[model samples]
Target: MKAVKWFAPHDMRLVEVPKPAPKPHEALIRIESTGVCGSDMHYYTDGRIGKTIITEPLILGHEYAGIVESVGADANPALVGKRVAVEPGIPCLKCEHCLRGRYNVCTTLQFPGGPPYDGALAEYSAVHAAFCFPVPDAITAAEAAMIEPLAVALHTIELAHLMPGETVAILGLGPIGLLTAQVARLAGAGRILGTDLLGYRVDVAKRYGVDAAYNAQTIDSVETILRETNGRGVDLAIDCARSTLTPAIACRVARPAGRCILTGISGEEYGQFPVDIARRKELTITWCRRFRFNFQTAIDLVASGRIDVRSLITHSFPLEQSRDAFELVSRAGENVLKTSVDQ
Candidate 1:
């Protein structure tokens, strides 16, 4: 099997490795496509995100899809030959969180692409069969891979608890932020405002459900959003920016008692926000772990054309160019939104 392995910062190589056989409850998938995510960038550049450090060569791609080549003895044989999107995280079903159906936060969760777990950035991956979701033939493999991030956006909205006609402000125009905007629009959010450090993303935000967006680097994002609401802040504010500062900005830009959801992975263990401001406003600050109970919804949205995942897939590369794919996504230059490494 051929795999892209990350040795150190900015160092990646396609190397040959032994193919993994499926465990009793696992399935061997012939990976078709994998998407580079923001969290992967952190590992590519610094070999770490907070305490989850990559001390050894690791394969970094969690957003992925493929066809089930075969299943283990205990695995479902129906999945064989089926194209599916596999959720990269495997939680211990015996854990309290998992028992409560909040498995995304299972303390002993095993997530691929994170440290100590080889991801689906190769020609083959053996994953737990239960996490795999079969998709309709209408969507491509790349779109199936996109279901991971779409699920994340869905989780963000679930945390936001958005109400119809409520205002929203997304503190970044990246893929997750853009997807969140789309979901918010579907939830009937009014006057969706977005801000991004990059001008290209801000320019494209309107196409993805943002009513108005601007370059935060060129102006005060909080001020503009506050003014946009006539001195009141948005009803729900989401932070999807790379900077940890965006969380504080989300709090500042949210109306009193409004909700602020932090979905951004800033690579920092500790983040600071205006505690006084958050306290005074009585804001509800929630941190999103990842997606839970949303993969089917995401797949349905994309399949129904309600959410266009194709628009964000601005770049694609072959398996041999995995390094190039990471580089392009890291730089995010030339209007790059999402990069998919296809087999």
Candidate 2:
């Protein structure tokens, strides 16, 4: 099998390794496509995100889709030949969190494409069969690979406890942020406002159902959103920028008692926000980790055409050109939203 492995900062190589076989409850998949995620870029560019450092050669991809080439003895034989979107994180079902259906936060969770677990940036991957969600023929391989991020967005919306006709402000127009805005819109958010430092991203957000998109570099995003909301701010604010400033801005732009959700992965170990403003507003702040039990919903949303993720896939590269894919996403150039590696 051929895989892309990270050795050091800005260093990734295509190497040959033994193909893996499925365990008793697993399936061996021939990887068809893999999305280059923000976390992949963080590892490729900075060699780390907080304390999760690349201390060893690690394959760097997680959001992926593939065909079930074979199944283990105990795995479902019917899954063979099916195209599936893989949920990359495997949680320890024995943990309290997992027992309560909150497996995304399981203390002993095993996530691929990080330090220890190799990811699906290769021709093949063997994953637990239960985590592989089958998609209808209507979903393309690229779209299937996107279900992971869509799941994250869905989880964030769920955490927000969004309601019909409530206003929402999404602070960031990256792939996740744009998807979050779309999900919020479909959830019946009255008005969806999106912001990003880049104008192109703002423009992209507008096309994806945001009522208004603002470039924070050009104007005060919090103030603008408040002004449009009659100085009361939005009913819900979600920060997907992972920047130190956006969470605080989310706190500022949320109405009194409004809910705020943080879904971005911060580079810094500790983030400081405007606690005073948050306290005064009596805000209900929540943090979102990777999705839990949302992959099926995400697939259904995309498969049913309720959410359009195809447009967000601005670039695609072959598995052999994985390095270029990482570079394109890392530089955030060419108005790229999501970059995927086709196998």
Candidate 3:
């Protein structure tokens, strides 16, 4: 089998490697599509995201979809020949968190593309069979692969505990932020305001879900959002960008006693927040860890045509061109939105 392995920052090469066999509870998936994500860029450009450093050459993809070529002895035989979106994280079911149904934070969770465990930027991946959710024929492989990010967006909106017709401000109009905006609307948010350092993202977001957006590079995003809300700030603020400042900015953009969800991975160990602002406002702050039990909801949303995940897939690359794909995402070049590596 062939896989792209990251040797250093900005260095990913296609290398021949031994094909993996499915473990007793795993299924061997012939990877069809893998979405390049901003979190992946953290490792691709800097070889780490906060404390999860890449110490060895590792295959780097998690947002993926594939066909189940085979299943292990204990795995579901019914899954064979199914086209599915494979969830990357496999948690120890016996853990206290898993027993409580919060498996996203299971203490022994093994997330591929992180380190040590190999990922799906390859010809095949062996993920737990239970984690592979089959998509309907109407869903393309690229869109199925997009389910991972959409799941994150769903989890973000769910954390907001939003009331119908409440206002929302999404910081960092990248794929996740844009998806968050769409999910917020579906959840009945009144108005959506978004900000991004790149103008291209801001423009693309308006078409996706944002009612109003601004280029933070040229404008003061906090002031602008406050002004848009008539100096009251937004009712709910979600941070889904790579900028560390977004955590604090979200606090400032949110109204007093409102909620703020920190969903972005800024790739830093310690991030600074506005302590006084959050304290005075008595804001409710929640940090989103990947997702939990949201895949089925995401699949339903995309399959029902309620969410447009396909339009956000602006670029696609072959397995051999994985490096170029990463570079494009790193530079945010060519008005690129979400990119997928396909067979």
Candidate 4:
């Protein structure tokens, strides 16, 4: 097997390694496609995301999809030829969080491509069979890889508890942000507004059907959205930029008693908030972790053509070009939305 391994900041190498054999409850997957995620960029560029530092050589890809090459005795034999999206996090099902159906927050969760566990930036990966969601024939390998981020978008919208026809403001136009906006629209949100620091991203968002898209660097996003909304503010605001300022902007642009969800992970351990404004507005603020129980919904959305996950894929590279892919994603090159690595 060949794997793309990260050793230090900006250091990655494709090297040969022994193929992995699955345990009784796992499946050996021949990875077909992998999405270079924001978290992967964090580890590649900074060598860590918050406290999850890369202290040793690590494979860095989680948003991935592949075919089942083989399965352990306990795994279903029917999955051998199935195309599936790999769910990268394994949680302790015995935890209170897992018991409550909030397994994403399980205290003992083990996420691949983070620290200790190696990921699927290789020719093969062996994951628990239960974590693999079958991809419909209608979805491409790239779109299948995208189900991971789409799941995040789905979870964020679910947390927002958006009502039909309610206005939504998505503060970021990255892959997740763009997906969030589209998912909100599909989920019955009216007048979706999207913002990004990059003009190209804003343009892309507009093309993706956001009712309005703004280049935050050139305009006061909050002002523009509020002005358009008749100064009433949007019913829901979601921040996907991981910018220190965007959360406060989310708080400011949400109507009184409206909801705000922070779905991005900031580099800083803590961020400042507009306490006075948020308090006065009585906003219901919440944060989104990765995702839980949304993979099937994400797949169905894309497979059914209700969501266009493929349009967001702006770049693709072979496994050997993993480093270049990471660089493009980290720099946020012109018009780039999502970058995928084909194994």
TM-scores of all predicted structures: 0.99, 0.98, 0.99, 0.97
Which candidate ranks first by lDDT, i.e. highest?
3
> What clash pairs does model 4 have?
none
Give me candidate 4's TM-score against the actual structure. Answer: 0.97
lDDT per residue as tens, model 2, 57-176? 999999999999999999999999999999999999898899999999998888999888899899999999999999999999999999999999999999988989999999989999
Off by over 4 Å in 4: none
Q: How many clashes in each candidate?
A: 0, 0, 0, 0
lDDT of 2 at 163: 89
Local error of candidate 1 at 2, Å?
0.1
Residue 339's lDDT in candidate 4: 95
Total backbone collisions, model 2? 0
Clashing pairs for model 3 are none
Global lDDT for candidate 1? 0.93
lDDT of 4 at 148: 98
